[model samples]
Target: MRLAPLDGGEDAETKPLWQRLGWMVAIWLVSVTALGAVAYLLRLWLA
Candidate 1:
């Protein structure tokens, strides 16, 4: 059987390197901010 690309398709490869990196950084920032907010709220609840 054949396997699909990890990124879902060729669209990710078609984009420029900087654009891809920018998207990754943006996603990482959003994820970190969300986790931090959750942790802060949990701390407030437990304290």
Candidate 2:
């Protein structure tokens, strides 16, 4: 089962450094925020 299909058209290396880094940072922030929210909810439920 393939989770992500490989696209033959777009080249990753062609993207600018800022755009690549921006996506990385954005994904990281979103993941962290989601984790924190889940942890808070779990704490409240356990308390």
Candidate 3:
């Protein structure tokens, strides 16, 4: 069977590539900050 359709799908979003990339970077930064906070807390608990 064929994979993706040649034409844009009904459910596919129309947002631009740069907007998507910016959102990805913002999410990554938030995730990193959360991990750093957890690590700091764990270190304090162990000490």
Candidate 4:
């Protein structure tokens, strides 16, 4: 298999609009999951 050149920002800049959106969604999901877990643990400890 051939590798795409490490043209800085080229892949990111040329990605379809949805690709950027998909990344944002994935990040948000991770953030929410982490925050929820922390809050649950804190509540469990305080209670």
Cα lDDT computed for each candidate against the true fold: 0.92, 0.90, 0.86, 0.91
lDDT of 3 by residue, 7-26 (tens): 56543468777887999999
Compared with the true structure, what per-residue lDDT tens digits does model 4 show for residues 1-47?
A: 64556656676889899999999999999999999999999999999
For model 2, residues 1-47, the per-residue Cα lDDT tens digits are 64455663367888998999999999999999999999999999999
Q: Roughly what TM-score does model 2 have, to 2 decimal places?
A: 0.77
- Predicted model with the maximum TM-score: 2
Residues forming the 10-long window of minimal summed lDDT in candidate 3: 3-12
- Candidates' RMSD to native: 2.5, 4.8, 3.8, 4.6
Backbone clashes in model 3, listed as residue pairs: none
Model 1 lDDT on a 0 to 1 scale: 0.92
| TM-scores, each model vs. reference | 0.75, 0.77, 0.68, 0.75
Model 2 / residue 11 / CA error / Å? 1.1
Q: Point out the worst 10-residue segment of candidate 4 by lDDT.
A: 1-10
Off by over 4 Å in 2: 1-10
Could you tell me which residue pairs clash in candidate 2?
A: none
Considering lDDT, which of the candidate structures 3 and 4 is the better prediction for this target? 4
